[model samples]
Target: MAIVVVGGSTRNIGKTSVVAGIIRALPEMRWTAFKITQFGHGVCSANGEPCDCETAEHTIAVSEERDALSGTDSARYLEAGAVKSFWVRTRQGQLAEAMPRIRKELAATENAIVESNSILRFLRPDVYLSVLDPATADFKDSAKLFLDRADGVLLPEGELGRPTWKGVSLRLLEGTPVFAMMPPIYVGPEVVAFVRGRLAAVAADV
Candidate 1:
């Protein structure tokens, strides 16, 4: 099976959109999609909502998304043609607790796509795409740490412009195949084609 991981520097930059678009664009992959979320203190990982629960026992939750119209990120995966969709939640520093379940889920799928930067800690995907918005300065530390590992990057539409993130040299992005993200879709045919080729190569090797 092939696994594709989509990650980004920060929130609301269309990482979810990119995953959904790939599922829609390549239905034959029969992708099983996962949205992994690690919530901060007092937040519920299962729902990505804030809660007062204070314990490591409540740190991890994984739930399948059944409602395509529910408007949740995992639900959007189903609506976009993923065969199965799941949301995995873990406390900010507790993703390790959820690895066994995550591994089992990926093992059962013919192909899997995960929306997470932290999951990279445990698994190396066949394709890892990072979404970046040069205009957005708030970079997640996890995303920043894994930045150079991306197979390719999806950038917001328009010029490269000045990067506001200090300590993040332009050299970090060097040699990466950067694709322009156009509006609502966020993913283009080129990105899809690159992914397809990567997966196909894996299949061929197998």
Candidate 2:
């Protein structure tokens, strides 16, 4: 099975839209999409709400999305034509606890598309796309840690003179393909072609 991961330098940078666009653009892949969220302290993973619980059961929660009208990121994946969609929630630095379940789902799928920079720590996907915005100043350390592994970087359509993020270097993306993306449909024709080519190449080798 082919695995593709879509991550962003920070939150609300259109990562979900990009993943959905790719799923819609390549429905023949029959993608099983995943949206991974890591909640901070005092938040319950079971429901993603503020809580004081610190139990193992409350540390990780994984649920399959069934309603396309739920207005959640995983629901958007279903609406984008993904055959299956999962939402994985875990406390900060606790994603390892959810991987067994995630791996089981991945093993049962044809093609998988996951959204998270942290998952790179566990899986080496066939294709890894990182979305970034020059306007956004907050660059998570997780994004920085895996930036060098991105197969392609997606940026805003306009010229990115200089990223506003501090202490972050673009040199990590040396030799990596960069694609310009806009809202509504973040995956452009070129991006789709690149992904298709990459997946095809992987399948050919297999």
Candidate 3:
């Protein structure tokens, strides 16, 4: 099966929209989509809240959408014609515990697209796209850890200027295959073409 991972430097940067756009553009792939959320300290990794009780297993919420109008990320995948959709939640640094279940879900599909950065640690996807916004200064540790592994980067629409963080330059990402993205919308044709071409090439190899 083919796997594509969509990750970003931080939250609310349109990673979900990008995944939806690709699923829509290539409906014939019959993709199984996944959205993974990792929670940090003092939070119930399963529900993204503070909890004192011990849980037996990490929470993995799966939502299958048959209608296109549903508004959740899983719904967006459904709207794009994905065969199945799931949302996986785990404690920070504990994604390894959820992989067996995740793999079972992925094994049941023909092709899959996952929205996560930490998922990269366990699986080497066919394509890894990193979404970034220079205007946003807070970069997640997970994003920094996998920045160099990104096959391509989806940059925000702006002058393409240099970004600095705590005296460190963010210009290193400029060298990668950067696609300028228009925010608050689905991906444009240029980004679409780039993804399609990469997927096509990977398909040819298999």
Candidate 4:
């Protein structure tokens, strides 16, 4: 099975939309989609109290159509015609604790698409696409850590404008294989074809 991971420099950067778009475009792949979320400290659950939880003991949640019909990212996957869907939640920087379960889920599918940058540490995906918004100044350390490893990048639409955050310049990403991605939408056909062709090559290499 081939695994494709879609990640971005920060949140709200169209990573989910890209995954859904790919699933819609490649329905024959029978993709099993996963949307991973890592919660920060002091987040409260039931009883309205902050709790310290072990990362290893964290649950890897799965949602079929009933749970998938909602407005969550997993639901978007289902709406895009994914055969199966899952929403994995874990502690920040604790993706390793969830890798075994995640791999188990991927192993059961014909092909899997995961949406996270941290997962790159455990498994080398068939294709790794990093979505970048040159206009957004905030760049997460996770994205920076994995930037050079991306097979290709999806850049935001319009002219390549300047983006600065805390004295750092995003111009460092210039000259990468960047596909222009307009706001609030999935990537265009050129980017999708590039990804599919690259993924096919990777599969052949294996």
**Which residue pairs collide, candidate 4?**
none
- Computed on alpha carbons, the lDDT of every model, listed in order, comes to 0.87, 0.89, 0.78, 0.76
Q: Which residues of candidate 1, in runs, are more than 4 Å off? A: 43-57
For each candidate, what TM-score against the reference? 0.92, 0.92, 0.84, 0.84
Writing each residue's lDDT as its tens digit, candidate 3 over 32-120 gives 99988776555643343675423445344334556567676678888777888886766667788889889998888999999999999
* Candidates ranked, most accurate by lDDT first: 2, 1, 3, 4
Which is superior by TM-score, 2 or 4?
2
Q: How far is candidate 3 from the true structure (C-alpha RMSD, Å)?
A: 3.4
Model 2 residue 137 CA deviation in Å: 0.8
Model 2 CA deviation exceeding 4 Å by range: 42-57
* Candidate 2 lDDT, 89-190, residue by residue in tens: 887898999999999999899999999999999999999999999898988899999999999999989346688989888789778898988777699999
Best by lDDT: 2
* Runs with alpha carbons beyond 4 Å of true place in candidate 3: 41-70, 167-174
Q: Candidate 1 vs. truth: CA RMSD?
A: 2.4
lDDT for each residue of candidate 1 in 1-206, tens digit (9 for 90 to 100): 88999998888889999999999999998999999887776765434467643446677788999999998999999999999999887778788999999999988999999999998999989999998888988888888889889999998883568977766766877898889899975878898899999888988998
Which residue pairs collide, candidate 1?
A: none
TM-score of 1: 0.92
